[model samples]
Target: MFTGLSAFPLIPTDENGIDEQAFVGLVARLAAAGVASIGALGSTGGYAYLSREQRALTAREAVAAAGTTPVIVGIGALRTRQVLDHAADAHEAGAAAVLLAPMSYQPLTDDEVFGLYRTVTAETTIPLVVYDNPGTTHVTFSDELHGRIAALPNIGSIKIPGVAAAAAPARIAALRAVIPAHVTIGVSGDWLAAGGLLGGADAWYSVLGGLFPEAALAITRATQASDSTAAREASNRLEPLWALFQRYGSLRVMSAAAETLGLVHSPNLPLPLLGLDPAGRSELEATLLRLGLGA
Candidate 1:
């Protein structure tokens, strides 16, 4: 059901807990920029670092701030039961959908992954989007696995990581051909969005879209209209940002951009995940300026 760009804004926070005011403003900004949906607790939102109460509170506050914008809450956990509980909490918080990733401390088998989704789908009535992000989950969904999960009742969509250069369009086509008619295939990784959108991805579950929705949405609208020239032009404007993503990390770059824009304060990300390097700050600032987003 996610047809175009969906924004995954950072859950702004400091050392103490969620910064409700900053978080609300971030979500409101994305909504105002006209993103298709607001995804709370996504990669940028630091779902793993938060406690149960914090996650629930963030989802609740996000929904309230989003106004009429649809909210998709992330509920990925190592344990299936924990995910179910989070999904229920998201549902109660008035979320429009829930996103699930196969995050594990212990290495997981295909069967374990399958069972996790099966159990979550059985217990949760809210629509679930399978997030096939091997970068974070350390578990990749095989072609067969993608089809199986998509067919499950209420499995509304799958957000796939963008593939290699040559594989995008064909891979998207293959995934679409196999997944149930009701299941949408979304693409993540901002750099891969151009090829994925041109290739027929149903949605762009985007990090950049959260920071600058109008720019990202311009690409979405252009791609949807099959205006390859415009799409490439918009995407070209992001070359510096994409390079930062490749060199530093999406979280680091996004946090830096958000802070530079005065959209939110530099968030206190979870342990082990550090802030954007001071060494790279000037470079990022230059990129931001070139993109016409004043630093």
Candidate 2:
């Protein structure tokens, strides 16, 4: 809640449906490992792939498992009414917040994005966080647009991908100046988080933290304590994992890692986005060992 690590874990699923026990167990593990919050239905969580029933059940189990640790449900969709429906289910499931990313097959204008948030926030009393993942959604959020959304009644946080390594600190600083102090700035893309944290960003919207919450917490705590050397060291130790993320995608790598580590079984990922190939398997498993995840 106070500018810490928020995990977006791989949404564990089986052939039948959302693996309730496996999903809840992962949430409990992250909470035990000191994650400030857990998010379900994120890009990594495969939100768009799930049916409305699957999404509702996933949110319910996640919130129940998280207990005191807050759960943020991704309500991102191609349409306003559909996103509103997810928000209603998430709030009813006891989620602490909803993450909104305006994704569509057709390109969207700035005004349309703002209107989507405005309508969803007005409909749900639960706090909403702006999820700006341009890489996947192709819906970029300009600084002016971020400021406008920050003024929305229930909007509370913005999850942004970090800028280039050299310019990250400056970008975070500039964003801080534009958005109100109460609105939190969270950095996603695991590779970009260290610079953002060093630059005073409030939270890390982490993917690997989905598996290694304590390790992510270590990096954040060191930065907050003003120990840049230790923070960088901690972040550097996980560089091997980031390499895999860049090459074959975080969702693929995370699913493979989770299965190899026995955290969960091989998942039934939506088609055209299956597990890693043979070469990726060898590389990813080796990195997991290097990171001492006992793969």
How close is every model to the real structure, measured as TM-score? 0.97, 0.97
- Give stretches of model 2 more than 4 Å off: none
Error of 2 at 239 (Å): 1.0
Q: Write the per-residue lDDT of candidate 2 for residues 1-295, one digit (tens) a residue.
A: 6378999888876556777777788889998887889988998889998899999999998998888999999998888889989999999999999999989899999999999988887888988889998989999999999998898898889999866657878888888878888999999888878878887788988898888788888898898898888988998998888889999999999899888888778754666578999899999888878788754
- Candidate 1 global TM-score: 0.97
- Give per-residue CA lDDT, model 1, range 1-295, as digits (tens): 4779999998766677777888899999988888889999999898988988999999999999999999999999988889988998999999999999999999998889999999999988889999999988899889888888888888988999976536888898888878888898889989989878888888999998888888899999999999988998899888888899989988888888888888776655655677887879889998889889774
Candidate 2 has its poorest 10 consecutive residues by lDDT at 264-273
lDDT of 1 at 97: 93
Record all residue pairs in model 2 with backbone atoms less than 3 Å apart, i.e. clashing: none
